[model samples]
Target: MTTLTQLEWRTMADDHRYLIRDMALGDTTISETVLHPDQSTKGHAHPWPEVYLCNAGEGTLYLDHDGGHPLVAGARYVIPGGVHHRVSTVKGVTFTCVFEGPRR
Candidate 1:
């Protein structure tokens, strides 16, 4: 098993738009991500289900025409496969995401 502390895996993005840390195995992936204010994921979809936990800050999770949810600290969200979605950071956002897929 692998484990990481928040500070242990804190890694900055190329553009410094966010910080991403991975704790994944096989096809299932888990990650912790932090975004600065106004940061977004560029709206995309994966083939697997995604689970998210908002750890801090406020933001909106946008899904095409379905609008968004005002993500508060400690909130949780789940997204099914093939649903185009992206996150918009308000005053900066931090979340952990889990992706379910085949075992490695």
Candidate 2:
């Protein structure tokens, strides 16, 4: 079995305070993000829907129409396809996004 430390991380192009990594699970892609304190995503959208699951820490999820929502460990949020969203961390957050096909 592969450990968490064994996963490969890549620099996120959207921001400097975040790191990302992707793993293929069957036909789906799981993208994990590591966000440092006071950091946030660049806000974007894709053609495929996604599920955001937080593993640790806490943050706020800003949606295109729904405004902002609290994000915490063990919580999950569904993001519809073509809808824009971004995440900001007060401390730090480690989360995984599950989506179909490949990363866009």
Candidate 3:
């Protein structure tokens, strides 16, 4: 068992612009991501579906070609496998992303 307090947060890279804490359980991976204002993630796709649970602040979830969906605290969004998607924040945001497969 693991707790948030036990997880160590780390930045991916200078260009990524976000902090993350990842935990692996069996075949699933749970990651906590924190994005500051004006920060965004690069659009990408996964081999399996991804689930995001908003924990704080506000943001937008951008889908391929389509526009974007508002992201608010306490809301959840699911992105299907192979679908391009990304996230951006205006007032900063923290969310938990759960992957259906092993941690990559």
Candidate 4:
């Protein structure tokens, strides 16, 4: 979908301020997540490498407990799996993450 409203967004898990929707085809999965203001995705990791596109807003992407980079709109990032990572937003952020295999 080209717009946020065009996608079937839904509350993700029990994480407050987090919303997500999934689109899967074949062996790939793409998930769109919106993080509200003053919230974070919490430090977590997956078993497979993935990529993320900063769809909107601004945020910081920290990996492996080290310094992070600014996540500006229109930016893309590739994060290897098994590495600790987290996203913290200021005025909220919307990002689309792509990974191989089905959504777990």
Candidates' TM-scores? Answer: 0.78, 0.82, 0.83, 0.83
State the C-alpha lDDT per candidate.
Answer: 0.75, 0.84, 0.81, 0.83
Q: Please provide, for model 3 over 1-104, each residue's C-alpha lDDT reduced to its tens digit, 9 standing for 90 to 100.
A: 77757765544434357887777666777888888889998778877899989999999998785789888999898899888988999888888888976555
Which sections of candidate 2 miss by over 4 Å? 1-15
Once fitted onto the true fold, the runs of candidate 1 whose alpha carbons sit more than 4 angstroms away are 1-14, 25-27, 101-104
lDDT of 2 by residue, 1-104 (tens): 86656655554443668888787665777888989899988889887899999999999988884668988999899999988999999799999999998676
Q: Residue-wise lDDT of candidate 1 within 24-100, one digit each (tens)?
A: 46566677788888778667887777888999998898875487887778889888888888888858988888887
User: Clash totals for all models, in order?
Assistant: 0, 0, 0, 0
Q: Flag regions of model 3 displaced more than 4 Å.
A: 1-16
Measured by lDDT, the strongest candidate is: 2
Compute the lDDT of residue 62 as modeled in candidate 3: 89
Off by over 4 Å in 4: 1-11
Which has the higher TM-score value, candidate number 1 or candidate number 3?
3
Ordered from best to worst lDDT, the candidate numbers read: 2, 4, 3, 1
Native-referenced Cα lDDT, model 2: 0.84
